[model samples]
Target: MASYQMLVKDVIKRADILLEVIDARFPDETRNNEVERDVARSKKPLIIVLNKCDLVSKEKLEETKSRLSKIAPTVFVSGKNRFGTTMLRHKILETAGIKGREILVGSLGYPNTGKSSVINGVAGKHKTGTSPISGYTKVLQLVNAGSRIMFIDTPGVIPFGENDEYIQGLLSVKDATSLKDPIGVAMKIIEKLCAENKTALESFYHITIGGQDSYDALILIGKQCNFLKKKGEVDDTRAAVRIINDWQKGLLVI
Candidate 1:
């Protein structure tokens, strides 16, 4: 995958259009400076594709789509499942008004945001390498999508340098997953769930956590949620593991 900086310059030099692929579940994390700068500088008509809509709630998804609608037409798609991918292509064609013109569509997003998966779906094959791991695509590769459309796949956006707003939006938009400080992330998730989904929390923890202190709740959650050590002590890793697992599986989608 090619770096956004390089792609920005190259798009200014060559491409006529830009399609930013953002994961709908984590739109704030995926839409960063690279996209903004590229679109702003190139003055190209931009199409924002909200990928991974399957992972997020419909209310949240519509809200995000409305938000992006202020700037560019937004299409919600699930790149992995091929949801809305065809509609997205049609939107691209309609926006560009060049059904037969050679068009360059820049596929971009942060790590694990499914840029390659979108390309593969658009191309009708697994031509681009996609994996569960983040940052799998290291170079910008161009894929042919029939006569008039070409998809340019770029590397995951680096949170560093010239794109902090996009990075911040992505990190804040999604549920707090990449907090790195797992304990803090877990605590936040637990507290949020305690206030929002008490029954699910109780089922997962087997204890009423609605009004418990955060620390006590954490321990109780650890015990019931399998975050316990062999000695039956509260283990931070196990606690964090459970919380992350729950968040990834949409059980903690508050």
Candidate 2:
């Protein structure tokens, strides 16, 4: 983690402008406040990119853009759908101007926030290695964003905060595939959805949670999704993992 922090610091120091990629679903959770501070201190223009906009509603996207614009130049994009990345590219090109040289543009974000996807989306042909697992791109790589722009892809930056395992799992910093208590962590995701918007969760999963708690709702979803174990038993762990996967992959609507 220390080495990753140092690398991020180096990237910030070297780049002319920084594009901080944040998750549209949970912008605050995915943002690296420390890196933003460093960017501010360095006096470089920072662009806050709300990635995975396809996972969110149009109204929600507007709300987030409006709210985040006050902090920095904000753009909402989805690498998965290849939407709004052109705007990101134009922003980078415009910011760097028509200089006859390479402009360093670095992307930094937490795991599963589509940083690599966004980079690859904008690069068009020069794609980077993107994966569902966290910390997949371990080293920094420079890919050309056309002829004038040099886009730098760095390792996912997970700042030190929120020690709660539940929050970590919720943000996808925790490895759900190897979690010791998948059901427990999965409950956190179900409970969060229920608390935030029970209707969306129930509607997406096609389950009813009327008068029932998160666990009950989860049980219904497990059966509905056919996550069954031996002897007709509900595979709570598998269901939990699927829920996490759904949320991470932006299948679950807010």
Candidate 3:
């Protein structure tokens, strides 16, 4: 954790501008407030790049953009579908407000937030390697983004002692098999889906959530999938893992 903090601070000091890449579905949760404060202290222009916009709805994106714009110049980007990359490029130059000399842009975000994908999208090529697993970028690499803009791609930043299983599970920072409390995390995911998009959750699981809380919904899903134990009881752990896997894979949208 200390190493990550040092890496992020070093990148922030070296770069001309900074891009805080966050998950578009859970912008608030994925954002690193401490890093933002460091960027603030350094007085560097920070652009909030909301990646994975394709996984979220337009209305939600607009709402998130409006709220986050108050803090920094926010841009919605879908690195998967190559959407909003042009807007992101324009926004980066517009935020920097400099020309002639190359602009060193530093990218920061939590694990699995699509920092590499965003970089690739903006560069219009696969300049940096990307993976679905978290903490894939181990070292900082500089890539030419053209237009007098260069990118300093840094590793994902997570604060020290940030061991919340639910946040990690939701952000794909930890895979379903990696989590110790998969059932608890899946219940939280169900509650979030129930609150935000119950219809999508129901449709994806093929179960009616009428009056059923997160636990009941989980059991029902297990029953439907025939994930059962010796006594025909629902195998909750397997069901929970399935739910988390589906959520991380973008199959269950909220």
- lDDT digits (tens) for residues 103-209 of candidate 2: 87878877667787898888886443332322333556777767566777776665545455655676677778866677787787787677666788988988878
User: Which candidate comes out best when scored by TM-score?
Assistant: 3
Model 3 poorest 10 in a row by lDDT: 128-137
Best-to-worst lDDT order? 3, 2, 1
Tell me the TM-score of each prediction against the true structure: 0.73, 0.80, 0.91
Q: Give candidate 2 regions above 4 Å deviation.
A: 96-100, 125-139, 159-175, 195-197, 223-235
Candidate 3 lDDT over residue span 1-254, tens digit each: 56788778778888899999999888888888899999999998999999999988888889999999999989999988889999999998899998789888889987788988888889875244332322233556777877777887765655425466788898888899999899999999999889778889988878899998899999999999999999999999999999999999999876
lDDT agreement of model 1 with the native: 0.66
Question: Which pairs clash (backbone N, Cα, C closer than 3 Å) in model 2?
Answer: none
What is the Å distance of residue 144 in model 3 from its true position?
Answer: 0.4
In order, what lDDT does every prediction score?
0.66, 0.77, 0.86
Best by lDDT: 3
**Candidate 1: residue 193 lDDT (0-100):** 59
Clash tally, candidates in order: 11, 0, 0
Question: What digit string (tens of lDDT, one per residue) describes model 1 on residues 149-183?
Answer: 77776665444445343333233423334445566
Evaluate residue 57 in candidate 1 and report its C-alpha lDDT on the 0 to 100 scale.
65
